[model samples]
Target: MAASPELEGTESPAPRGPRELRLYGLNAVHAAFAKRPEAIRKLYLVQSRIPALQPLLAWCVAHRVGYRVVEEADLEKLSGSAHHEGVVADVLRAEPESLSTWLRDLPAGPQLAIWLDGVGNPHNLGAILRSAAHFGVAAVLLPKHSSLALSGAAARVAEGGAEHVPMVRLGRTDNALAQLRGAGFALAATVVAGGRDVFAADLPTRLVYVMGAEGEGMDRELARACDLQLSIPGTGAVESLNVAAATAVLLAAWRSRRPG
Candidate 1:
C-alpha cells in the first residue's frame, strides 16, 4: 500500500428538497412510484392531464402521498424543464449503497459493474446509468473526487433507469480495485490504444468495466491496476466515442456475450 494516496470522495448530491429529490417527467415519476412509493413526499400534476394520470393519482391517494393538481406552467417552473410532460414529485432521498455492501451481496454468478473515473456531466451520468440498467450492471462506482451529482436532469435523461441501478461512491481508487480483485472481479480498463478489442476479447463473467474521462483517459495508476486493458474497436474518423456512447457499446457487448 503506497500510503493510500490520500483517497477522498463526495457522496452524490443530496436530494434537492428538504429530505426530497425533485423528479419530473412520466418515466422518472413512474419509476419512483413503482419502485419506492413510500419515498414520495409530494407529487404535482397538470390539471388538464389528470385523466391520463388517474392511475397514478389513485395510487398516490391510496399510499397517502401528498399531491397537487396544478397548471402545466407550474410543473414547468417546478421542473425547470419544458419537457416535464406534466408530472413532478419531491421524492424522498435515496441513500447510496456502500461499495462493500454491493460486493458482499453479489450472487453466485458473474457480476457486472461500471467503474467510472468520474461523471463529467449529468446527462452522461444519466445515460450511463440507463445503459447500466439495460445490461443488468450491479452498480456504478464513481471516483472519490468526482464532482458528478445525480441531479433532476440526470433522472429525466435516465428515463427511470436511475431507480434501477445503484450509484456507489469509492474511496482510494487502488483500495477499491484491490477489494474488487479479492472478490474475484476481473477489472477491464478501457483505453484508446494498446488494449484488446472488447467485442472479441475473452471477458470475465465477474467483471468491472473501467471508463475514465475522455480527454485524460484512465490515470496511470488506475490503468496499471486492471487485469486486462481493453478498447471498443471503431473505424469511424471520430477520435473516440464519448463516455456515454462507449459505455453503452461496451455494456451491449457484455449483454450479447451472456445472452439468456
Candidate 2:
C-alpha cells in the first residue's frame, strides 16, 4: 500500500455532513466531481487507478482534499461492497428540493418526470435514475413519507446518471397532484393491466409517470387520482416487467413521440 497523500492547503477533510455517502465506481466518482468538486470530502483508490484519475487527483491536491492510494481490499472495506471498481469517494448527500421550490423554478415547456410511489430498492432506484437521465427526465419526485434516498450502491449502478437528475420532495399526495395539474402536467399512472397501451396512448407533453412498487403495486387511490392510466402490452410469459424496466420503457415511449 502506498502512503496516503498529504493535502498541502486544507487542515483536514470538510466537516462530515449528517448524510455523507461513500460513492464508488469510476463513473460515479468522476460524475460527482464533475458536478460538484466542492462536495467531495475524501477519496480512496487502488494504485493502478492513479493514471486514469490524474485530473481528479490534481484537483484533490489543488483543493487540499485528502486522497489515498490503498489496496483493492481496503477500497472494498471502505465502500462496504466488493464492486467499488477501483475507486471510492466520500461526498455530501445532495438534498432534494421541495416541490414548491422546484415548481417555482421549472421553466415553462414540455417536460417529463416520474413519481416513485413505493419503489425503495436502491438498485431499482439507480436503474430508474439512469433511464430518467438518458431520456432527459425533468426530475424524480419523492413523497414526503417515502424512505427512498440515494445510496452508494445506487450511485454506482447509476453510472453517473444520478448527477444529472434532480430529486424533488413532495409533501402530500393531494397537494402534489393538484400542483402538478396546475403546472399543466398530466399524470399517467402505470399499471400492469387494464390501461391504455403505452405505445398507442397520446402521451402529454408535460407528463408525470406514476411508478408503483414491485410487488403490491401503486396505491389504488393514487391511480384513481391520475388523469389517465397506461400499460405495456406483453406476452403472458411473466406477470409484468420489473418496476425499473417498466419505467425505462415508459420514458422511452414518451420520448419517442417528442422527436425534436
lDDT of each: 0.81, 0.91
- RMSD (Å) of each candidate, 1 decimal: 9.6, 4.1
Q: Residues 81-149, candidate 2, lDDT per residue (tens digit)?
A: 799899989998999999999989999999999999999899999999999989999999999999899
Per-model TM-score, in order, reads: 0.89, 0.94
Please write out the lDDT profile of model 1 over residues 48-98, one tens digit for every residue: 767877877898789887678776656666777788888878887677667
Clash pairs for candidate 2: none
- What candidate 1 gets wrong by more than 4 Å, as runs, is 1-18
Model 1 TM-score? 0.89
